[model samples]
Target: MCISNPNSISDQTDLVAMKARLWALLRKEEHEWLQKSRLKWFKEGDINMKFFHLTASSRAKRNQISKLKEIPVKRLSVGSRRLLERLFSEEEVWNMSCRLCLIEDSSFNNSFISLIPKIDEAVSPEDYRPLSLVGSLNKIVSRVMARRMASCLKEVVGENQFAFIVGKQIVDCVLIANEVIDDLSKKKKKL
Candidate 1:
Protein backbone atom coordinates (compact mmCIF):
# COMPACT_ATOMS: atom_id res chain seq x y z
CA MET A 1 0.00 0.00 0.00
CA CYS A 2 1.21 3.50 -0.97
CA ILE A 3 0.84 6.44 1.45
CA SER A 4 -0.02 9.61 -0.53
CA ASN A 5 0.08 12.04 2.45
CA PRO A 6 2.63 13.69 4.82
CA ASN A 7 3.04 10.29 6.57
CA SER A 8 4.80 8.93 3.39
CA ILE A 9 8.09 10.78 4.27
CA SER A 10 7.97 9.52 7.87
CA ASP A 11 7.13 6.02 6.61
CA GLN A 12 10.18 6.03 4.28
CA THR A 13 12.43 7.14 7.16
CA ASP A 14 10.98 4.41 9.37
CA LEU A 15 11.52 1.83 6.63
CA VAL A 16 15.20 2.86 6.30
CA ALA A 17 15.65 2.63 10.06
CA MET A 18 14.06 -0.80 10.13
CA LYS A 19 16.30 -2.00 7.29
CA ALA A 20 19.43 -0.79 9.15
CA ARG A 21 18.29 -2.50 12.37
CA LEU A 22 17.55 -5.72 10.51
CA TRP A 23 21.03 -5.69 8.88
CA ALA A 24 22.71 -4.98 12.25
CA LEU A 25 20.85 -7.88 13.91
CA LEU A 26 21.75 -10.21 11.04
CA ARG A 27 25.47 -9.23 11.32
CA LYS A 28 25.40 -9.78 15.09
CA GLU A 29 23.83 -13.21 14.65
CA GLU A 30 26.44 -14.15 12.00
CA HIS A 31 29.30 -13.03 14.28
CA GLU A 32 27.91 -15.13 17.17
CA TRP A 33 27.58 -18.17 14.90
CA LEU A 34 31.15 -17.69 13.61
CA GLN A 35 32.47 -17.59 17.19
CA LYS A 36 30.51 -20.73 18.08
CA SER A 37 31.84 -22.52 14.96
CA ARG A 38 35.46 -21.63 15.92
CA LEU A 39 34.88 -22.96 19.47
CA LYS A 40 33.69 -26.24 17.96
CA TRP A 41 36.68 -26.33 15.53
CA PHE A 42 34.38 -26.11 12.50
CA LYS A 43 35.88 -24.87 9.26
CA GLU A 44 34.30 -22.35 6.94
CA GLY A 45 32.54 -23.16 3.57
CA ASP A 46 30.38 -25.81 5.27
CA ILE A 47 26.59 -25.32 5.84
CA ASN A 48 26.10 -27.08 9.21
CA MET A 49 23.68 -24.85 11.13
CA LYS A 50 22.22 -27.72 13.18
CA PHE A 51 25.71 -28.94 14.22
CA PHE A 52 26.71 -25.37 15.11
CA HIS A 53 23.62 -24.89 17.30
CA LEU A 54 24.13 -28.26 19.03
CA THR A 55 27.83 -27.58 19.69
CA ALA A 56 27.06 -24.02 20.90
CA SER A 57 24.47 -25.31 23.39
CA SER A 58 26.75 -28.15 24.53
CA ARG A 59 29.62 -25.65 25.00
CA ALA A 60 27.31 -23.30 26.95
CA LYS A 61 26.32 -26.17 29.21
CA ARG A 62 29.93 -27.33 29.70
CA ASN A 63 31.21 -23.78 30.35
CA GLN A 64 28.79 -23.10 33.19
CA ILE A 65 30.82 -23.26 36.45
CA SER A 66 28.74 -25.00 39.14
CA LYS A 67 31.34 -24.98 41.94
CA LEU A 68 31.95 -22.00 44.25
CA LYS A 69 35.08 -22.74 46.30
CA GLU A 70 37.59 -20.35 47.81
CA ILE A 71 41.21 -21.32 46.97
CA PRO A 72 43.95 -20.56 49.54
CA VAL A 73 46.80 -18.45 48.17
CA LYS A 74 50.44 -19.13 49.18
CA ARG A 75 52.85 -16.20 49.11
CA LEU A 76 56.64 -16.69 49.05
CA SER A 77 58.75 -14.72 51.54
CA VAL A 78 61.61 -12.33 50.54
CA GLY A 79 64.33 -14.54 52.08
CA SER A 80 63.18 -17.63 50.13
CA ARG A 81 63.05 -15.62 46.90
CA ARG A 82 66.60 -14.36 47.54
CA LEU A 83 67.79 -17.94 48.21
CA LEU A 84 66.22 -19.14 44.93
CA GLU A 85 67.93 -16.30 43.02
CA ARG A 86 71.28 -17.18 44.60
CA LEU A 87 70.84 -20.89 43.76
CA PHE A 88 70.19 -20.10 40.08
CA SER A 89 72.92 -17.45 39.69
CA GLU A 90 74.91 -16.93 36.44
CA GLU A 91 78.01 -18.59 37.90
CA GLU A 92 75.99 -21.72 38.84
CA VAL A 93 74.49 -21.75 35.31
CA TRP A 94 77.96 -21.45 33.75
CA ASN A 95 79.20 -24.36 35.93
CA MET A 96 76.21 -26.43 34.84
CA SER A 97 76.86 -25.61 31.17
CA CYS A 98 80.54 -26.62 31.52
CA ARG A 99 79.54 -29.93 33.14
CA LEU A 100 76.90 -30.74 30.45
CA CYS A 101 78.14 -34.10 29.07
CA LEU A 102 75.87 -36.94 27.94
CA ILE A 103 78.38 -38.98 25.92
CA GLU A 104 78.49 -41.88 28.37
CA ASP A 105 74.72 -42.03 28.95
CA SER A 106 72.88 -44.18 26.38
CA SER A 107 69.51 -42.80 27.50
CA PHE A 108 70.38 -39.26 26.40
CA ASN A 109 71.91 -40.54 23.13
CA ASN A 110 68.85 -42.69 22.35
CA SER A 111 67.37 -42.50 18.83
CA PHE A 112 64.11 -43.91 17.43
CA ILE A 113 64.09 -46.19 14.40
CA SER A 114 61.02 -45.80 12.20
CA LEU A 115 60.18 -48.35 9.53
CA ILE A 116 58.97 -46.75 6.31
CA PRO A 117 57.45 -48.91 3.61
CA LYS A 118 59.62 -49.04 0.47
CA ILE A 119 56.86 -50.58 -1.62
CA ASP A 120 53.12 -49.88 -1.75
CA GLU A 121 52.31 -52.98 0.26
CA ALA A 122 55.14 -54.03 2.56
CA VAL A 123 54.70 -57.76 3.26
CA SER A 124 58.27 -58.71 4.26
CA PRO A 125 60.90 -57.02 6.45
CA GLU A 126 63.05 -56.32 3.36
CA ASP A 127 60.22 -54.29 1.82
CA TYR A 128 60.48 -51.77 4.64
CA ARG A 129 63.39 -49.37 5.10
CA PRO A 130 64.60 -48.32 8.55
CA LEU A 131 65.07 -44.58 9.16
CA SER A 132 66.92 -43.38 12.26
CA LEU A 133 65.40 -40.37 14.01
CA VAL A 134 68.15 -38.91 16.19
CA GLY A 135 67.46 -36.84 19.32
CA SER A 136 67.26 -33.05 18.97
CA LEU A 137 70.19 -32.56 21.34
CA ASN A 138 72.43 -34.82 19.22
CA LYS A 139 71.41 -32.98 16.01
CA ILE A 140 72.01 -29.55 17.61
CA VAL A 141 75.42 -30.57 19.01
CA SER A 142 76.55 -32.14 15.70
CA ARG A 143 75.34 -29.13 13.66
CA VAL A 144 77.22 -26.73 15.95
CA MET A 145 80.40 -28.88 15.66
CA ALA A 146 80.00 -29.06 11.84
CA ARG A 147 79.62 -25.26 11.59
CA ARG A 148 82.76 -24.75 13.70
CA MET A 149 84.74 -27.30 11.61
CA ALA A 150 83.50 -25.85 8.27
CA SER A 151 85.28 -22.52 8.92
CA CYS A 152 88.71 -24.22 9.05
CA LEU A 153 87.95 -26.87 6.40
CA LYS A 154 89.50 -24.93 3.47
CA GLU A 155 92.82 -24.44 5.29
CA VAL A 156 93.09 -28.07 6.43
CA VAL A 157 91.96 -29.74 3.16
CA GLY A 158 94.29 -30.01 0.15
CA GLU A 159 93.53 -28.71 -3.38
CA ASN A 160 93.28 -32.22 -4.93
CA GLN A 161 90.50 -33.36 -2.55
CA PHE A 162 87.07 -32.26 -3.87
CA ALA A 163 84.50 -34.14 -1.71
CA PHE A 164 83.13 -32.48 1.52
CA ILE A 165 85.01 -29.20 0.67
CA VAL A 166 83.05 -25.99 0.09
CA GLY A 167 82.15 -25.19 -3.58
CA LYS A 168 83.64 -28.57 -4.68
CA GLN A 169 81.89 -31.75 -5.76
CA ILE A 170 83.05 -35.38 -6.11
CA VAL A 171 81.87 -35.25 -9.81
CA ASP A 172 84.72 -32.71 -10.47
CA CYS A 173 87.23 -35.59 -10.17
CA VAL A 174 85.34 -37.55 -12.85
CA LEU A 175 85.35 -34.50 -15.16
CA ILE A 176 89.11 -34.00 -14.63
CA ALA A 177 89.75 -37.69 -15.34
CA ASN A 178 87.65 -37.50 -18.56
CA GLU A 179 89.65 -34.42 -19.76
CA VAL A 180 92.95 -36.18 -19.04
CA ILE A 181 91.80 -39.26 -20.93
CA ASP A 182 90.64 -37.16 -23.93
CA ASP A 183 93.99 -35.27 -24.00
CA LEU A 184 95.95 -38.58 -23.84
CA SER A 185 93.81 -40.08 -26.64
CA LYS A 186 94.27 -37.05 -28.93
CA LYS A 187 98.08 -36.53 -28.43
CA LYS A 188 98.99 -40.22 -27.79
CA LYS A 189 101.07 -39.11 -24.74
CA LYS A 190 102.54 -41.45 -22.06
CA LEU A 191 101.31 -41.26 -18.45
Candidate 2:
Protein backbone atom coordinates (compact mmCIF):
# COMPACT_ATOMS: atom_id res chain seq x y z
CA MET A 1 0.00 0.00 0.00
CA CYS A 2 2.82 2.47 0.93
CA ILE A 3 5.46 3.27 -1.75
CA SER A 4 9.09 4.43 -1.00
CA ASN A 5 9.49 8.20 -1.62
CA PRO A 6 12.79 8.96 -3.43
CA ASN A 7 12.21 12.74 -3.01
CA SER A 8 12.62 12.51 0.80
CA ILE A 9 15.89 14.51 0.59
CA SER A 10 14.04 17.81 1.24
CA ASP A 11 12.28 16.34 4.29
CA GLN A 12 15.65 15.12 5.72
CA THR A 13 17.20 18.55 5.13
CA ASP A 14 14.32 20.26 7.00
CA LEU A 15 14.76 17.94 9.97
CA VAL A 16 18.52 18.68 10.05
CA ALA A 17 17.86 22.44 10.00
CA MET A 18 15.33 22.19 12.82
CA LYS A 19 17.79 20.16 14.91
CA ALA A 20 20.54 22.74 14.33
CA ARG A 21 18.24 25.62 15.40
CA LEU A 22 17.19 23.74 18.57
CA TRP A 23 20.84 22.99 19.44
CA ALA A 24 21.78 26.69 19.08
CA LEU A 25 18.94 27.74 21.40
CA LEU A 26 19.90 25.12 23.95
CA ARG A 27 23.57 26.23 23.84
CA LYS A 28 22.58 29.89 24.39
CA GLU A 29 20.50 28.97 27.43
CA GLU A 30 23.30 26.83 28.84
CA HIS A 31 25.80 29.68 28.44
CA GLU A 32 23.50 32.12 30.24
CA TRP A 33 23.02 29.65 33.09
CA LEU A 34 26.78 29.17 33.41
CA GLN A 35 27.41 32.92 33.54
CA LYS A 36 24.77 33.41 36.25
CA SER A 37 26.11 30.46 38.26
CA ARG A 38 29.66 31.84 38.08
CA LEU A 39 28.49 35.29 39.23
CA LYS A 40 26.64 33.82 42.21
CA TRP A 41 29.65 31.67 43.17
CA PHE A 42 31.98 34.69 43.05
CA LYS A 43 29.53 36.80 45.09
CA GLU A 44 29.58 34.18 47.85
CA GLY A 45 33.38 34.45 48.34
CA ASP A 46 36.59 36.11 47.06
CA ILE A 47 37.04 33.55 44.31
CA ASN A 48 38.37 35.13 41.08
CA MET A 49 35.83 34.18 38.42
CA LYS A 50 38.16 34.89 35.50
CA PHE A 51 40.78 32.53 36.93
CA PHE A 52 38.10 29.91 37.58
CA HIS A 53 36.72 30.11 34.04
CA LEU A 54 40.19 30.05 32.49
CA THR A 55 41.04 26.88 34.41
CA ALA A 56 37.58 25.27 34.04
CA SER A 57 37.46 24.20 30.38
CA SER A 58 39.40 21.68 28.31
CA ARG A 59 39.96 24.33 25.63
CA ALA A 60 41.82 26.44 28.16
CA LYS A 61 43.82 23.38 29.18
CA ARG A 62 44.86 22.80 25.57
CA ASN A 63 45.79 26.47 25.19
CA GLN A 64 47.99 26.25 28.30
CA ILE A 65 49.68 23.05 27.04
CA SER A 66 52.49 25.01 25.43
CA LYS A 67 55.34 26.03 27.74
CA LEU A 68 55.75 29.28 25.79
CA LYS A 69 52.28 30.45 26.77
CA GLU A 70 52.21 33.92 28.30
CA ILE A 71 52.62 33.90 32.06
CA PRO A 72 52.33 36.98 34.25
CA VAL A 73 55.22 37.65 36.61
CA LYS A 74 55.96 40.45 39.08
CA ARG A 75 59.58 41.13 39.89
CA LEU A 76 60.19 42.14 43.50
CA SER A 77 62.22 45.32 43.89
CA VAL A 78 64.09 46.67 46.95
CA GLY A 79 60.97 48.39 48.35
CA SER A 80 58.88 45.27 48.01
CA ARG A 81 61.65 43.21 49.59
CA ARG A 82 61.74 45.59 52.55
CA LEU A 83 57.96 45.43 52.93
CA LEU A 84 58.03 41.62 52.85
CA GLU A 85 60.81 41.56 55.43
CA ARG A 86 58.90 43.86 57.78
CA LEU A 87 55.72 41.77 57.45
CA PHE A 88 57.67 38.59 58.18
CA SER A 89 59.42 40.13 61.20
CA GLU A 90 56.14 41.48 62.63
CA GLU A 91 54.53 38.05 62.27
CA GLU A 92 57.53 36.47 63.95
CA VAL A 93 57.32 38.92 66.85
CA TRP A 94 53.61 38.18 67.28
CA ASN A 95 54.20 34.43 67.37
CA MET A 96 57.08 34.94 69.77
CA SER A 97 54.74 36.91 72.00
CA CYS A 98 52.40 33.92 72.05
CA ARG A 99 55.26 31.62 73.00
CA LEU A 100 56.40 34.10 75.66
CA CYS A 101 52.91 34.23 77.14
CA LEU A 102 52.93 30.44 77.40
CA ILE A 103 56.30 30.47 79.21
CA GLU A 104 57.13 33.43 81.47
CA ASP A 105 55.15 36.64 81.48
CA SER A 106 56.86 39.37 79.34
CA SER A 107 59.76 37.06 78.50
CA PHE A 108 61.55 37.99 75.27
CA ASN A 109 64.32 35.39 75.21
CA ASN A 110 62.63 32.35 73.70
CA SER A 111 64.23 29.70 71.50
CA PHE A 112 61.68 30.06 68.73
CA ILE A 113 63.71 31.11 65.69
CA SER A 114 62.56 28.06 63.71
CA LEU A 115 58.87 29.10 64.00
CA ILE A 116 59.30 31.99 61.48
CA PRO A 117 59.04 29.80 58.36
CA LYS A 118 56.07 27.93 59.85
CA ILE A 119 54.23 31.20 60.48
CA ASP A 120 55.11 32.45 56.97
CA GLU A 121 53.70 29.23 55.44
CA ALA A 122 50.57 29.49 57.55
CA VAL A 123 49.99 33.09 56.40
CA SER A 124 49.93 32.37 52.67
CA PRO A 125 48.53 34.66 49.95
CA GLU A 126 45.06 33.11 50.29
CA ASP A 127 45.05 33.91 54.03
CA TYR A 128 46.10 37.56 53.49
CA ARG A 129 43.51 40.19 54.36
CA PRO A 130 43.45 44.00 54.21
CA LEU A 131 45.01 45.73 57.21
CA SER A 132 43.03 47.98 59.54
CA LEU A 133 43.74 51.72 59.92
CA VAL A 134 45.55 51.27 63.24
CA GLY A 135 47.59 48.39 61.81
CA SER A 136 48.61 50.57 58.87
CA LEU A 137 49.67 53.37 61.23
CA ASN A 138 51.78 50.93 63.23
CA LYS A 139 53.41 49.75 60.00
CA ILE A 140 54.26 53.34 59.09
CA VAL A 141 55.89 53.88 62.48
CA SER A 142 57.87 50.67 62.05
CA ARG A 143 59.10 51.73 58.61
CA VAL A 144 60.24 55.14 59.87
CA MET A 145 62.11 53.47 62.75
CA ALA A 146 63.75 51.08 60.29
CA ARG A 147 64.95 53.97 58.12
CA ARG A 148 66.38 55.70 61.19
CA MET A 149 68.14 52.53 62.26
CA ALA A 150 69.64 52.07 58.80
CA SER A 151 70.88 55.66 58.90
CA CYS A 152 72.43 55.08 62.33
CA LEU A 153 74.05 51.88 61.04
CA LYS A 154 75.45 53.79 58.09
CA GLU A 155 76.93 56.43 60.43
CA VAL A 156 78.51 53.78 62.70
CA VAL A 157 79.79 51.55 59.92
CA GLY A 158 80.03 52.87 56.33
CA GLU A 159 77.46 53.83 53.72
CA ASN A 160 78.56 51.01 51.42
CA GLN A 161 78.02 48.32 54.09
CA PHE A 162 74.70 49.83 55.24
CA ALA A 163 73.41 50.17 51.67
CA PHE A 164 72.47 46.47 51.79
CA ILE A 165 70.41 47.00 54.96
CA VAL A 166 66.68 47.01 54.31
CA GLY A 167 64.96 49.95 56.03
CA LYS A 168 61.72 48.07 56.83
CA GLN A 169 63.58 44.91 57.80
CA ILE A 170 65.23 46.54 60.84
CA VAL A 171 62.24 48.70 61.85
CA ASP A 172 60.81 46.39 64.48
CA CYS A 173 64.22 45.66 65.95
CA VAL A 174 65.07 49.37 66.12
CA LEU A 175 61.74 50.20 67.72
CA ILE A 176 62.07 47.45 70.34
CA ALA A 177 65.76 48.00 71.10
CA ASN A 178 65.21 51.59 72.41
CA GLU A 179 66.74 53.14 69.28
CA VAL A 180 63.51 55.14 68.93
CA ILE A 181 63.75 56.25 72.59
CA ASP A 182 64.22 59.96 71.80
CA ASP A 183 61.30 59.94 69.37
CA LEU A 184 59.04 58.35 72.01
CA SER A 185 60.32 60.71 74.69
CA LYS A 186 59.31 63.73 72.57
CA LYS A 187 55.76 62.33 72.39
CA LYS A 188 55.39 62.30 76.23
CA LYS A 189 54.18 65.63 77.65
CA LYS A 190 55.07 66.51 81.26
CA LEU A 191 52.07 66.15 83.57
Best of the candidates, TM-score: 1
Q: Residues 61-154, candidate 1, lDDT per residue (tens digit)?
A: 9999988899654554565444434433456444433555435355655789999999998999999999998864566555545544565565
lDDT of all predictions: 0.70, 0.55
| Model 2: CA > 4 A from native | 1-7, 47-191
Candidate 2 yields a Cα-based lDDT of: 0.55
Question: How high is the lDDT of residue 69 in model 1?
Answer: 94
User: Mind giving the per-residue lDDT tens digits that candidate 2 earns over 48-105?
Assistant: 7676566567567786746576865445556645644554456545554454343344
The clash count for each model shown is 0, 0
Which candidate tops lDDT? 1
Q: Ten consecutive residues with minimal summed lDDT in candidate 1?
A: 80-89
The collision pairs in model 1 are none
